[model samples]
Target chain A: MIIDVSDPADPRLADFVGLRDAQLRRSEDRFIAEGLKIIERAFAAGAPPRSLLLQPRWLDGVLPLLTRFPDVPVYVGTEAMIEEVSGFHVHRGALGSFDRPAEATWEALLGARRLLVCEEIVDHANIGAIMRVAAGLGWDGVLVSPGSADPLYRRAIKSSMGASLELPWRRMGGAADLARLREAGFTVVASTISPRAVDVDAFEAPEKVALLLGTEGAGLSREWLAAAGAHVRIPMTDRVDSLNVATAAAILAHSLRQRG
Target chain B: MIIDVSDPADPRLADFVGLRDAQLRRSEDRFIAEGLKIIERAFAAGAPPRSLLLQPRWLDGVLPLLTRFPDVPVYVGTEAMIEEVSGFHVHRGALGSFDRPAEATWEALLGARRLLVCEEIVDHANIGAIMRVAAGLGWDGVLVSPGSADPLYRRAIKSSMGASLELPWRRMGGAADLARLREAGFTVVASTISPRAVDVDAFEAPEKVALLLGTEGAGLSREWLAAAGAHVRIPMTDRVDSLNVATAAAILAHSLRQRG
Candidate 1:
């Protein structure tokens, strides 16, 4: 059913408002994915949208998809109403909210030989890029630290080219969760550019390895690095300091996966 | 001396105008690097700024640097004037223009054991990120194909965390450049995800190697791949496809540098 919402203040659209704050609170473990192409890919990948909001003009293109999920509501609104309701420009003409998948267990994620563990990576774009890399390089799954940005954040989902939706991922509560990963027989490898760290290539790949990446600015914290099984550094020129966290994660993921 | 001008149309600030167009035209070969931090880093790295333009209010803070380059013209203007002159908001509080460095020859770039060769990657941010990765991963320089975006583009420089200024790079004029690089004894390894390509880890480090990267969407052209000494791929899982071009380059650059 197409419900037209002329009022911007309609409580029905509350799911999409103040998303960043909602994400911080963990009250809304959901995110909006924009654009028809990405939404279609998400649906095709078996990830169903919890709800959808679209301009009347897009109904013709979206109606066919709605047929696949009869129970889900397709909220229709005027362009002006969506812009006001979204509190941002909705230039993509369509948006959909999807629930974050249930957290995958460590057993499922660490089953593969290679994986990525994002430690306190707060930026949505970086998280998205890391997901894209993880998927592109064939890493098993991603483990997000408690403070990391939600992989399902609207911007991250868009930035990942919707790969985040397709990729398997889970969040670790904190250091305790990381401890569980360590106990699970996974070799936790921390990436840092510090002199004390062995060159990344020198680190032998184990049967199960988790590549830990931190934020772009400060890199992995000492506490976290000390907790890891090994600290690895990407060999760099003296003039060049470091790679973006996402890029660093990609390199490590590619290297670890290729070790087989 | 700091010359103040309230008029936005002052001909002295021509180099700082319409930066969007300036970013696209290699013939003009001009790009803007905003913010005091990036501009200062560029200057400290020996990439001289051709001119400095700043808000008159910031004269006190920027004056010391301005004094160091007496020969370089320093144009001071009101925030409103700077915005009008540049056709964009001047949020960085300062902007500077620099002369494009002389293009490095293929031989000059390959002298180092490792280098990055970009083939038609048009996004400025990707170009910038690749440059940062190349530098951080101990690669000597970068070579761009004709169709690639200029590394000097404003956004590219910012994305690179200002490493674009510190790295040596040049644009390849034609196939002849690749031919010359081949003749110079640099092993050109093209990165791909094709079924038949050897896993990226298989390539032993040569004395001099040029890791060739292509646009993310289509990947390296068949002709380019055929011309390369070997085709290498970053192994990925069945569900995941490919990584972003810059991230992929970072992985490949790190691997090659580590091997060396």
Candidate 2:
């Protein structure tokens, strides 16, 4: 079903309310997928939709995808009412509430050859972009630090172009996870700007590698840098402080791609 | 000069008004640099300062740099007043107005071994991020299509972390510029996700190369693609449609970096 809706304050529209409030949405159990494309991506990734709030114009396009989920409510409304309920301009007049998938297990990641370990790379867009890069470059998985931004956040998922839904990723428990990964025969290489760091292009590719990346502020923690098998730096012209986290991640992901 | 201004609409503060109106600022002869760090970067880049609008807290920090341009106005006010003047929340209570520097000449870019030619990459942040990547990866210079976003836009400059000011970049007159670049002995490589494109890692890079990038919405125009010496693509898995334009640029720049 397509159920009609006019009242912005309708109790059924609670999930769509204040969609712009990142803080409010963060503590919720379900993640919101905005726009027709992302909503479709969520469905493709087997994310069960709790409900969908959209305008009548989008009903025909979305109906085919909802065939498997007959129980999920499809709340149709006027553009004005949808905006009123969302408390923000929803992109392309569609939003889907989906059950957040369970975190990917370390065992699943351990079976892979290449991975990205993010240390406090907490910007939502950056995290999302990294996931997109990882997925595109065919990195096996990603592990975000405890303090990193939620990859499931709406903007992050959107920024990742729905890769967050498909990529195998989870919150890394702590720095100790690094030790365990190393013990499992994965070489941990940190991406740093330290002058003594080996140039990534010049470094030898290992059989199994975990590329460690850090935030631009403090860089990889001194402790984490020391624990890594090697520190690799992308050579620069000394004009910029550092590349944006996501940009740097893409370069590293490309450099460390698992060649067939 | 420390000039206290409490009113946002004061005629003397005309250069700093409505900083959020990107179109209005773009038409003017100067560009706005938001945040104290960018303001410092602007000075360090040797961009002439027209004026400065900042809160009193930043006065001491800015005064040392303004000794050479003692005549440039320094307007100080409360944070609230500064926000009002900017028509947005000013970054760390500072914004600098600098004379837009002259564009880099084709001859200057022709001398470089590695360059980037952006085709309608209109997003300011993407433009800035690409500049930062180019600067970091040692790309000699950048040439943007006529419709591309201004690298000196406030957000672009901030996104670039001031690399927009330091990096050698200029806008090309039209598609004819590409033909001219080819005549200048630069291999024009188009970056596309087209299936027929050669993988960047597999494609042999030329000694003098100008990588062509397109907008994410549409790949490079047929004319540009046809003109390219080679069409190279970064290998991607099936998860994401394509990498973000900036992310893709970084990968390509790193892959085709000018090695010493």
**Reference interface contacts recovered per candidate:** 0.88, 1.00
Model 1, runs deviating above 4 Å: A2-12, A18-26, A55-61, A71-84, A106-114, A258-260, B3-7, B22-25, B55-61, B71-81, B89-91, B110-113, B258-260
Determine which window of 10 residues in candidate 1 chain A has minimal summed lDDT. Answer: A18-27
The lDDT of model 2 is 0.89
* Interface DockQ of each model: 0.64, 0.87
TM-score, candidate number 2: 0.95
Across B1-260, the per-residue lDDT of candidate 1 in tens digits comes to 67877788788888887766644446765557788877876777666678889987666766677666888888887788888888888788788888776777655776766778889989989999988888777788899988898888877888888888888899988656777778788888989988788866677878888888988878888778877998888776655556778887877776677452
Q: How do the residues B155-237 of candidate 2 rate in per-residue lDDT, one tens digit apiece?
A: 99999999999989998999999998899899999999988889998887889999999988788999899889899999998
Candidate 2: lDDT of A222? 80
Quantify all predictions' global Cα lDDT against the true fold.
Answer: 0.78, 0.89
lDDT of 2 by residue, A150-250 (tens): 89888899999999999999888899899888988999999998889898888987989999999987899987898899889888778888888888888
Q: Count the backbone clashes (under 3 Å) in each candidate.
A: 3, 0
